[model samples]
Target: MMDAREGRRVAGQRAEGVAARYLQSRGVRILKRNVHSRGGELDLIGMDQEVLVFFEVRYRGSGSLTGGAESIGYHKQQRLLKAAAFYLHRHSLWNHPSRIDVVAIAPGITSQYRVQWIKDAIQASP
Candidate 1:
């Protein structure tokens, strides 16, 4: 039997895979998956045309109280931003346009999972 942590990790990997395929079908070229840095981790990194995209993949089971997107609270967003910045600095892509996107996955009626892609979902406060 799989332990709770292992089960959750597997589920998250599956969701990230699904999100990657879904994005690829929509013209986003995936660059990397599970990018970890000192700051934080980026679930998926891709290019949407000329812009670099940092994707945060969130999955929620059918019985969960909170939706997938809603679970990304303030601290989570800050971490994502920090991670994205670290990625940019490491790659020297500061001049390149970039945005943070969220891919929320939930149980679907017809499909095994339903995906909601929110482009530029989180922005840095000015």
Candidate 2:
């Protein structure tokens, strides 16, 4: 991979770590990390309040104009949706209530790692 691509991968991993920590702090139980399926790859999977949670971790380096959330385009969303379905079926939970979440991380000075957790980010077909 090129330098930019490598950097992006590293940043995404950092974002996932931050997101997982943040979710854990909120009492969410992590079930899996980097789960891949027909839909796409889910960065993190957890349980929160009796609901299955699928998370997408996005990160933007310092000095970047757009924030992390903006990086998640429509294609990414569609993949995540399909991935969620795959996960559900693989786990044999067709009727369980589930949700998708987005965790945006903006790394900067002072402390770095600014996180934004968006709940119910995307809806999956039933």
Candidate 3:
């Protein structure tokens, strides 16, 4: 019997998996998933052709008040930015083009899930 937290975690993992598959179908080659750094955890890391992409997979159940992408507040965005920076520096890939993307998932009527892939969804402060 999974507790509420565990159940949520499992569901989140499933959502990520679904998002990964969806992205792959659209030509995103996933390199990693659930990557953790000192700043925060990155949901997915992949390459879209020549660019490196850091994907944030957000899943909102049918009953949730906030939508998937809408749930990410300013603080969360900052953490994601920092995590992406850490990843880039660690891999010495600063020269490569990179951007943060969001894969927002929600319950769908006609399909199992509604997925919206927003490109370059997060940007660092100038």
> What value does the lDDT take at residue 67 in candidate 1?
87
User: What's the lDDT for residue 99 in model 2?
Assistant: 90
Models 1 onward score TM values of 0.98, 0.88, 0.98
What are the lDDT scores of the predictions, listed in order?
0.97, 0.86, 0.96
RMSD of each: 0.6, 2.2, 0.6
Better of 1 and 2 by lDDT: 1
Clashing pairs in 1: none
**Model 2 Cα lDDT, one tens digit per residue, 1-126:** 569889878767877888899899999999999997767899999999899999988877777788877887788888998898898899898799999998888875667667888898777546
Candidate 2 wrongly placed segments (more than 4 Å): 108-110, 124-126
Output the TM-score of candidate 1.
0.98
Q: How many backbone clashes does candidate 3 have?
A: 0
Top lDDT model: 1
Show the colliding residue pairs in model 3. Answer: none
Model 1 lDDT-worst window of ten: 38-47
